[model samples]
Target: MTATDPAMTALAHSWSALSLLHGRIEGSVERALQTEHRLSAREYSLLDVLSRQHDGEGGHLQMRQVADSVVLSQSATTRLVTRLEDRGLLSRYLCPTDRRGIYTDVTDDGLRLLEEARPTHNTALRKALDQAATEPVLAPLVRAVHQLQGDIPRPDDRP
Candidate 1:
């Protein structure tokens, strides 16, 4: 169908609505984390992932793997890792077997900071979602968004 077609118009509106919701929720969470914990949303996300890895074992993921998991570009992830390293939140090391590859792991300080920020981040997100759900016009979209998240597999759930 053409861009101006009714079906296309409806699809565009749907995408726009989803994008707006994402921005709103993300902004709220980011502000809360940054204000209370001095951590950006992306930084908190990376720390959370590394904390999980730390719990599972001492194994660390390569830089590229971290970039993919956190939906960041390689260059951006590299910069972020450098920032976190400077803050004593994480460390990077060359792979023992493959010298070309670099692995990243969360430090004790990173885990502690993540633990401090998690509650703030989660509460902000939940409040935003709950507010949206209370609005009759947005309730269906909110429910759909929640369901979509549930449908996506977590790392451990993947085969």
Candidate 2:
């Protein structure tokens, strides 16, 4: 379909709205996290992800997997890891089975910071969505998000 086609235009508009929603949420959460815990959103996300690792087989994630989860390139993820490591918030180690593979884990300090930032992150997210829901174009998207999260009851749940 041509760029000017009605369907194409609608698709572009939907994409733009989604991007705007993401940006608004991230920006709000970032500011709150940074102010309250001195942690950036990405740093908090990485710490949260690493904090969930376990001793069970396949519990720890490879660098690539961590990068994918955080939506960053492997090199960038490594750099972030290094920075956190320097701050004593994270530690890296070579995989026991494969010396070639490395894994990162959150330190006690990281876990403490993550726990403290959790409420701020959640509050900021809720505030962002609440504000966005007041906008005519974003209200539906906000509703859709709540519906997906099961925050809003589905029609199927109605008697």
Best by TM-score: 2
Badly placed stretches (over 4 Å) of model 2 are: 152-159
Candidate 1 C-alpha error for residue 144, in Å = 2.2
Candidate 1 local lDDT, 1-159, one digit each (tens):
676999888888878877777888889999999999999999999998777764244467767778998889989999998999999999887877779977788888998999989888878888788787887656788899779766333325556
Best by lDDT: 2
True-structure lDDT of candidate 1: 0.83
* TM-score of decoy 2: 0.91
Candidate 2 lDDT for residue 9:
93
User: How badly does each model clash, as a count of residue pairs?
Assistant: 0, 0
